[model samples]
Target: MHRSRKADAPRADRVGRAGSGALALLAIAATLAGCQRGSSETPTVPTTGPGGCPAVRAAAQAAVAQAERTDTAWDGPTTGPAAVSGRTVVFVAETMTNPGVAGVANGLREAARVVGWDLRVIDGAGSPAGIQAAMSEAVTLRPSGIVIGGFDPGSTAQQVADAAAAGIPLVGWHAVVAPGPSSRPPLFTNVTTRVEDVAGISAQWIIAHSGGRAGVVVFTDASVPFARTKSDLITAKLATCAGVRLLAYENIPIPDASSRTPREIASLLARFPDTWTHSVAINDLYFADAAPAFRAAGRKGTGPPFNIGAGDGDPSAFQRINSGQYQAATVPEPLTQQGWQIVDEFNRAFSHRPASGYVAPTHVSTAANSAGATTWDPPGYREAYRRIWGR
Candidate 1:
C-alpha cells in the first residue's frame, strides 16, 4: 500500500521463490491505499495459529497504509503525450550491477516490450553528478514516462518535479523517495519496503533464532537510504531483545569497489574477541569482505562461530548460504518486479479507472533454497505484459 505524508530518515539479506503473474493481480486488490497504519504500530500477525491469512491481510493493510501516508505526492494533473502507449519509456538507475536494482531495470524493459512501448536504459554509476546528467538527458527525449532507481530524492527532487512538471509521470522503482519530515516531494508511485518493516522482520528473525541472545557488529554503506534505514531499525529493535546486544554499528569507510574485507574482518576479530552469534548486514554488496572473515575466524554455524551474513540475494550471498558459510539472508523479488509494478500503475494512470496505489512486498530465501538460485526472472504476467507491449 502507499501513503501521503513524509518525514524523517535513517537506514536485506536472503532469497525466496519466484512469483507468478497472479501476483500483480493480487497486489492490485490487496494494496489499495488508506489501509496502511503508522510506522510504530505493528498489527497482530498470527505468530502461531491456523487460518493466518486474516492476520496477514491485516499486516498487508497496515503496510499499504504506511506507504500511502509516507510517499504521498501532489497527485499532479495528468501529463505527457495524449497517447501514452506509443511514447518511449526510459529507466535510469545508479548502476546495473547492483543485483536488486538490475532486476528492476530488466522488469521495466520486459514490461515495455509487453506493452509495445520503446525502452531506453541509463546507468549513473552511483555518482550524483552522473545521475543528474542522466536525468537531464532523459527529460530532453520527452519520453512518455520515466522510472528511477536508488537516486536520492533530496538531491534530485527538483529534477523529478520538473519531469512531472513536463507532464511525464515520474515513477520510483525499487527506491522510494526518502521519507523523513524533511524528505522532498514524495514519489508519485513507488514499490518500496519501508525501512522499519525490513528491520523489524530481521530483528524478529534474529531474536527468534538466537532465543533473544546475540551480539552484533554492523557494517553499513551510509550512502544508501535503504541501508541506513535498516541500520536504524535494527538499532532500535535490538534494544528490545534483552538477550541481544549490539557491540558496534559503525560505518565502514571503504571506497567504491575497494576491497576492505580483509581489514574489516581483521578488525572485527580483534575488536570483538568474545564473538557474536549474528552479524547484521544491510546488503549483499558489503558481504564481499565480511562473510569470508567470519568463516576464516571460525565464527559461523549452529554454535560457537558467529553466523556470517550477506544481506540481500546477491548471487554470492545465495552461494554462501547454500554452503553453510552464512546463516540466512533476505531476498526480495528482483527489482524487476518493482519496475513492472510501477509500469503497470503508470499504464493504469492513463486510464480513467486507475488504481490509487499499490505495494509489492518481498519474500525471504534461506540456505536450503539458495543453492543455484537466480534473481533475474521475468514477471509472472509475462504473457499479459507482452500482450500489452507485444512479442
Candidate 2:
C-alpha cells in the first residue's frame, strides 16, 4: 500500500505510529508498485431463486453486520520465552513509507527488544525485484529466521527456498491467508488479516446501508493481494443482491492510485451518470480523492454513488466514517499489533514450537461508532502479550 502521512506523527485521538530507525531508511524508496491486470471486465456472480436476490443480499449483509460487532478470540502464544538472546531476525517489508506498514515493522522491533533478539529490516519498495534483493540480503546474514511483510508468496518462492535451504525458518506477516495453497509452500507461519472476511464485511455494509439495492463500482489494484481478494469477494457479495448491480470495475495499479483513481472514478461516473449509488475501494487511500470527484460529477441528492474503504485505519477515514457523509464506513487493520505478532510467530517457529500466532480481532467502523476509536487492537493487548510472552 501507499502512505502519505508521517509514521511518527501524532493522531488526534490515537497513539502515534510505531516506526523505528529502520523504517526511515525504507521511506525514500517507498513508492508502491505491483503486477497490473489486463482488463477490468468482470461477470457478476450468480445468485438466484425465491425471495430473490434482494432477500438473499439483505440476509447476507445483515449477517456481516452482526459479525462486525462480534469479538474474535486471540489464539497466539500467551506464555513462553519471547526471544532467544543474541539471536538475529530479519524483516523485509514491501514498504515502510506506508504508516501502517511502518508501524508493523516497529511493533516487531518492540517485541524483539523484550526477548533481546537482534532485528534487521529491509524495504522491498513494492516490487518483485526489491523483494528478491531484500530476501537475498537477509539470507546472507544467516539469521535465526526471516519474515516477509506484505509481499506475494509466489514472487518470493525462490528466495524462500533459498532461505529454507540455508536452515532459516521463513515466516510471513500480513501476506497470505492461512492454509495457503498446497501448491505454494506455506510459510512456517503466516500472520494475516482475513481479507475475505474484510471484503464480506464491506460488501454487506454497502448492501445494508444502501438498502440492499445499489449500483457499485469496485476498485481493485494488482500490486497487493488484498485488492484482488477484496474486489472478487465484494463483487460476489453484491451479485447476491437482486436489486443491486455492478456498474463497472476499475483496476488501478499501485503507482497510479493517487493520480488515476480520481480520473477513473470520474470517468466511470460521467459515463454512467448517477447509476452508481455507492462504490467500494480496496482501501481508504483508493477512495481518498473521491469526494471532490463526486461533487464535480454533480452527485447531489443522494442518487450519486458514495464510497466505502477497507483496511489501513487512516485518521481521516475514521472521522469521515463518523461523519456518515462522503465516506460511509471502513475496516481498520491493527497494523502495530500485527507487527508484534510477526515477531511472536517467528519466535515460536524458531523454537520448533507449534503454530500459535494468528491475529483474530477486527472491526468495521461507521459514522455511528467511529467516534473516539483509533486502532483495532483491544485495550490492554500489549499487556496481555507481555504476560503471555512472560516478559
Instruction: Compare the candidates by TM-score and give the number of the best one.
Output: 2
The per-prediction CA RMSD against the true structure, in angstroms, equals 11.5, 10.2
Q: Could you tell me the lDDT of residue 160 within candidate 1?
A: 78
Listed in order, each prediction's TM-score against the native is 0.70, 0.79
- Would you give me the overall lDDT of model 2? 0.63
lDDT of 2 by residue, 213-291 (tens): 6777777774454455456556655665666767676777655677777788677866777566888887786766666
Candidate 2 ranges with C-alpha deviation above 4 Å: 1-58, 70-83, 177-183, 223-226, 295-304, 322-325, 357-362
CA lDDT of each prediction against the hidden true structure: 0.52, 0.63
lDDT of 1 by residue, 1-391 (tens): 1111122332211100102222232232122111122211121221222332343344444543342231233232232222246757788776666666666777777676766778888876656777777788888888877777655554566677778789877666544422211113445565555445555555555555555566665555544544544554555554544455566554543233236655666675686677555666666556655656666777653333234332345566666655666545553444555566657666765653343354433445565443456452323444444344334
What does the lDDT read for residue 377 in candidate 1?
34
Q: Model 2: C-alpha RMSD to truth?
A: 10.2
**Clashes per prediction?**
48, 4
Give the distance in Å from residue 175's predicted Cα in candidate 2 to where it truly belongs.
2.7
For candidate 1, the 10 contiguous residues with the lowest summed lDDT are: 10-19
